[model samples]
Target: MVSPLTVVKSEGPKLVPFFKATCVYFVLWLPSSNPTWFSALIKCLPIFCLCLFLLAHGLGFLQTHPSATRIFVGLIFSAVGDAFLIWQDQGYFVHGLLMFAVTHMFYASAFGMKPLDLRKGLVIAVLSGSSYALLYPCLSGAFTYLVGVYVAIISFMGWRALAGLQLIGAAWRWTKLAAGSGALLFILSDMTIALNKFCFPVPHSRAIIMSTYYAAQMLITLSAVESREPVEAYGLSKTN
Candidate 1:
């Protein structure tokens, strides 16, 4: 039997380069704090590389489970959201938020197909409800309703992820854990974005948000690739 760490290690060739690129982009891009054509182009590279990483893993699993395709689609939308958010001054903030909202819907659907854990669902509801309540007052004008809708969808996504943790088989335990944790991290990153944009400024907010976001995406991608059963029908051995 292969350990989860071994499974992850097998994909290191594809993942390592992108991880290095992400780290490089963060080091160079965040501290500069000024958006120019060059900076925007550089900023987009990390997001694009991360998307490629997810897609590589997602496609590897697609032959085994159709749900893997959904994960790929979700990552694509996340990349789009990253692009829009990178260019906030070009009237893309709302578009970025909408893209992420759609991305969470895909994630929710992927996780919701399995049996749900009621206790986790209740916890998500309470946390999301209280967060919205607190942030709603801070947002003004049209953003209040728009951000509210985003909050609801992301909460549902997180809930479904938690529910998925209860449904995985023993072989897939680590995958589910990684995915569920990724979902929670995704929510945390978004909450930081919301607070930074609406309520108050967070010190080193960009670094915090982007680091968490990248980590979440990478973990989810790993889950998608690692959870599927070995494709014997495709002449692939379990060891493969």
Candidate 2:
């Protein structure tokens, strides 16, 4: 029988080319401010691959925890959001936002199953509230209300992720941290999107926003895998 360790070692090298291809496609897609169908398809390939990667890892972790399935579902929603947003000119912005809102819900549900620190959750809530206060003046009408709702949900997701950082297992520590950081970055990326779309035009905002968004998704996916590792191997217990 093939050892899990050996399988991991063998599979590790395959990711290098996948990552390289994603980078190449992203770079090519970046030059066209408004890309043609072919260019848009190329741009979407990286996100599609990233979603596949997340799904694969999430499925692999399913034996360890049912929460892993939530991660997979979240990634699927994220991929749909990516597809919608890629064609923003076709009136898909609202659709993309709704998809992502659902994505955050799944992610939040997954993280919420873990132990949380109430104090940290409170701190994150305050921060998110402050951010919304700053952005509210720039928005108006129905868009304002929609954005506000999105902010609230995504903020709650981030808070749950941050609270997970205090979880007491060593094997889960890095995973929790990565997931928390990813949640924060996801908020940052969405905030940037709101600012660029409603408040002001940020220079090179597409590159900045997509880079953070991709990194956030990747990190969250990695955390799902990391979260499945055995705590005993790291000489730690689940209790604080």
Candidate 3:
């Protein structure tokens, strides 16, 4: 039988998606107005609040589940990236790119840590390498160094994920899959944004990128919680 506290705690994870959705709405609604310099400062309050909420809630979840720390860190980087994008200072793009690259690397590590064979590392390498190769051609000299560094990080992350797969315990497979899927979504979100920025320059790029990013982060948090809680509780009960 489940305890009352467990029931209440479970609700916390459910709230993550709604809070993330609210943040997405605020990000979209505000930039449309094109606020004055001073007005833009004021306009930032809502988005700022959203980031704070996500950061706080994410950290709270991470405290009990260390395995999810990478995902939480990714959320932090993504929030920073979003802030840079909103600021619209051309100098900030590199910073945003770096932050997002870190975010993807974190997810790759998280996915690689799943309970699969080490040979699966080759698959991850192929996937990440193919992605970088396709995207690299479109990146300009302005971002050449940054992209090169980011590509290296991505490759390392893929290798890390593959290496970690050998360490995943049997009972943790489901949890790992849930967490890995969330990480995969984050990779997709970042890839889409990079494509939009360097290659296509789509109209609703901002909304589309942010929507996937936020969803991926929140799902990741929930996945961590789900994966850890069951294992911890089950272990405790068995030991008792």
Candidate 4:
């Protein structure tokens, strides 16, 4: 025997737009009611909304498809981490990093690094590595290993993406640039969060960093979706 609630759950995929709108509204309304409690919920809601949004887009419900499964996975893990951090759950932090690492690897694969020139890859690597080195000292002892793995994976991904942009040229330059910038910010935000959690405590830095990080991700993905070239332009011979 199933209740109406179960039925609604079963039908959720069909009503994605409505669900997204409601989630957006609810999160927006949270700040006034109970700031602390709702803020936590708002942190978690983005993950839920992102997952649903990606699923809906993949299923052809959305107007454009960015094929950003990798990036979305990063967001999902980040949101989960944010939820855990908000509640001060250290156990889930490792899980979040593991998920984020996988996301970075996927993004690296999407960048398709094989064709990139060595000079460009070297330049990108140097830039990313320098940035990571600057922040490495600030991470918590417990999170250091996980952060190391994350830094390696995401840095490589960023390098590959940058190389891809350079090699591929302006065909989709803005889109890739947006994604690269988003990835960089995402890394910074996570490092700041770890610092706050286990090393130095800061006030409200978590929220501010995360807000910017999440916004960067959304913009990157939107740019990617808008930058896709038409398949027909490949100019294959028209066979009867």
Q: What residue runs in model 3 are displaced by over 4 Å at the alpha carbon?
A: 1-9, 12-17, 20-28, 32-64, 104-116, 151-174, 227-240
TM, every model: 0.85, 0.80, 0.64, 0.62
- What's the C-alpha lDDT at position 232 in model 4? 37
Clashing residue pairs in candidate 1 (N, C-alpha, C atoms within 3 angstroms):
none
Clashes found in each candidate (C-alpha, N, C closer than 3 A)? 0, 0, 1, 0
Best by lDDT: 1
Q: TM-score: which candidate is best? A: 1
lDDT of each: 0.76, 0.73, 0.57, 0.57
Q: List the candidates ranked by lDDT, beginning with the highest.
A: 1, 2, 3, 4
Q: Rank by TM-score, highest first.
A: 1, 2, 3, 4
TM-score of 3: 0.64
Instruction: Point out the higher-scoring one by TM-score: 2 or 3.
Output: 2
RMSD of each: 4.3, 6.4, 6.6, 10.2
- Tens-digit lDDT string for candidate 2 (6-105): 6458545535544765687766755544646666566556556655665555454564554466777887788778777777777888999999999999
Q: Where does the lowest 10-residue lDDT sum fall in candidate 3?
A: 160-169
2 or 3, greater by lDDT: 2
